[model samples]
Target: MPRITVAEQAGVGLDGAPRPSEDVVLVRPDAVIVLDGATSLRPELPSGGWYAHRLAGQLAEELAAHPDAALPDLLAGAIGTLAAAAGLTPGHSPSSTVALLRWTADRVDALVLGDSPVVAFGPDGPRVLADDRLAAVPRRGGGYRDRLRSGTGYGAGHLRALRAGGAAMDRLRNREGGFWIAEADPRAGHRARTARWPRSAVREVLMTTDGVSCAVDDYGIFPDWPAVLRHSVDKGLLSVLEMVRAAERTDPHGIRWPRPKPHDDQALVHVDFTEIPK
Candidate 1:
């Protein structure tokens, strides 16, 4: 089996309270599972982190029972099981992004939903697996990002704006031509983007939630994917997380990146296939 390393941290809210991270990371004998719970805008329902933890728990059980199952099929079944338990329709439930990778002696399989992503370092360098549908969805003009840009920080008015934007986004969730996430709808699992690679072609693979990936993609911490991977190998995934947090600290008011939070829950897994025994 390949050598594996995992790192995770809960994000702080705007108020700097120490809240539970909504991200989950599971390292199985043959797979890696990463889930990022959606941020909850409402006060009544269970938080997105709660749902993500539940979904990750369910997936852990299912994957252990069927190690050889198709990635999407397994996801769909687990989702259906969760939906039945909740007795809720697709849009009515809390949601999360999913990034899963399973491997055998011959090949490796991956699935991506929401913004969570995977990066594989192969002979040709780095290749990315991501779900961009959520980014493609139309968004409100004066929402969170706009508020951050205008120096509102995260306040009551910012929360209101966030909710209004979330309401608009909720309408598009799980709908045709809109983005798909792991919610009450099982079909969204089937809609996840999937990919495969020859085991021999891949040297190392990294799975990360949007919190970490946004640093590489949006924050421009590194020039490219190769640099990101190299840094992780040189220092560690925890160091990367620290670097991201440090970057956020420099711009406490969100004038630079204009994100929803100063720090997001960071979850990452690194698999070193090269470290496998001969």
Candidate 2:
């Protein structure tokens, strides 16, 4: 019973070459699904974007076949199914963030894994449902930030530092005390943060990959979450993404905001809960 509008843009590589977005947004009859795949650094392993595309399809199928199934079970099953088919290994495989929002007759449910967030807005203002574990875990290597602060832009040294950081994180992935993500491991799904609310209490729900979220989360493109919702509903979600891209263009060297790249693939979905289920 909600009206959903979706927006997406493929990000450019460091060289400004157009690349396919790893983020995926899938809509089931009663659910909204979003995923942000981690960029792959190793040439031996399939890219994270490839993994995300297949996993999204599998998860969509599982959700459609079992409408009343638990979210965690569905997620685990989907991940396991995909991994088996792809012959993916636990530590060697690619991973993705997961966000889901579903509505039933009386209530709505939301889930978040990795950094992608699911936000619900209503009379209580905004309730942000996000998984902060990945951020909480300190990175093993981040010398690039130091180098950038010292006046070096996104050069070869910066890329080497980036690869080192990714390799460090890979060592800790899916392990106890490390953050969980939707990778070859099925248990990560069970680790997803989940929340439920009365359908009447929710007026709108916003789901996004960190690309769009960086506007508030990092870019400060908007003042806050409520402002994001206002602008999205007024101008459209695509407009919000354009603002983010504009900001990225201004800070091409990662000086203004030290990030892995100039831009990341973005996906956003805004769901209005006023309409009846068709």
Candidate 3:
């Protein structure tokens, strides 16, 4: 069996309120899973943290029950479980950003729904697994008809739009327009999914909400994913969470941090995926 090590962090913002930023890394002999919940601006629906918690918990549960299942099937089951658990009412429903990783003997499989992204690092360099959509939900539709579906929400819609030739979505991602949606709706699907290059002994895997990604520049400096992973592995994920809290306290202006996104709820998980003999 391959050894898997995971570290995660989540914290409240200066607004003194809870934001949804959930993470999960399930280690199997062959694979691991990572999920993140996107934060939302709407007050009517369930908090992003609530949705992320449910999705990550349910994903972990389903994967545990059927360890050999495909990534899509597992995601479908998670959606059903989430819908059943939270009910279908849009006013008080759950939504989030989800990413899954399944490693096989000679290859690795990944599935992403919404903005929370999966980044894989090996001896070569870094490759992203998810769409990195700005927001996870749609905005045009409205009323009961716009109620988000069981398997979709802010993160999902945001990604779907990007994949559908929506220039705004692409520009938003490239220029750091921010990862959150101004509004929440069902039709707002971003990108459905993406895969990764097959490889063994993945050195590092990351699942993070939009908040953290927005902080990075083209070179990935100023708390880049790699740097974040190293810090987590050394000091512990909880310590990183505390660091975000402290950053909010000391550098609320973002003058020192100087990231595109000044502040918001943030969470991330770092996993070191070691190779195992088949």
Candidate 4:
């Protein structure tokens, strides 16, 4: 069997208040899952953290019951289960990004929805699997962080503006020429990006939510994904998160690295397949 390690941390809110992290990490004998809940703009509805926790639990159950099921099918089934249990309406409920890895005796499979990432380290080097369509969507008010930092009295206004912007983005989701996410719609599972590789071709694998990925994608703290993976294996995964926090501390404002929040919930899972017997 392959060896697996995971690490996670809750991030502070804009007001410097700590909240429960919305990131979820699951490691099973045959699969690994990492999920990041989309931040909620509306307080009346269930929080993204609530949704992510439920979804991850359901996915783990579904995968355990049907270990041989295809990745897409497993996701679809889990989404349906969650929607029914939560009684959420499509386009109006909380959602999350998902990254999944599953393996058999001969091959490994990967699936990604939204911005969460999965990287496979093989003889050819690192191959990153992510969905970047969210970046293409146009945001209003100079983006979420700008509005939040616009002035002292703009906090509520910023959230309201974000709610409006999110509504528009919702329309573009789960469709052609737009992005897809795991909201109330199980069909989004069909739209996820997936890849397959022979077991021999994979030496190690890494799965992370955008929180941890921001270190590479947003801050440029590490030169490349390979460096991030090596660091995680050499040190602890939490050390990578500490590095991100150190960078954030240096740039307290959005001037250096523009983002909605200073800190984000982080979750990561590392798997070493090289030691598994063939």
Candidate 2's C-alpha lDDT? 0.88
Tens-digit lDDT string for candidate 1 (52-129): 888888898889999888899889988899889987577778899999999998999999989999899999888899
Please write out the lDDT profile of model 3 over residues 23-109, one tens digit for every residue: 444455555555454343344656656666666667678878997776667776676666666674433354566667776556777
Instruction: Write the residue-wise lDDT of candidate 4 on 43-124 in tens digits.
Output: 7888888898899899999999998888889999999889998898888899999999999889999999989999999999
Best by lDDT: 2
Task: Please give the distance, in angstroms, between residue 185's alpha carbon in candidate 1 and its true position after superposition.
Answer: 0.3
Give me the runs in candidate 1 sitting further than 4 Å from their true place: none
lDDT of 4 at 85: 84
lDDT of each: 0.87, 0.88, 0.53, 0.84
Misplaced by over 4 Å in model 4 are: 145-154, 276-278
TM-score, per-candidate, Cα-based: 0.96, 0.96, 0.61, 0.92
Candidate 1 TM-score over all chains jointly: 0.96
Give me the runs in candidate 2 sitting further than 4 Å from their true place: 140-142
Q: Candidates 2 and 3: which is better by lDDT?
A: 2
- Model 1's alpha-carbon lDDT is 0.87
Q: Using lDDT as the measure, name the better of candidate 2 and candidate 4.
A: 2
The candidate, 2 or 3, that scores higher on TM-score is 2
Worst 10 residues of 4 by lDDT: 147-156
Backbone clash pairs for candidate 4 read none
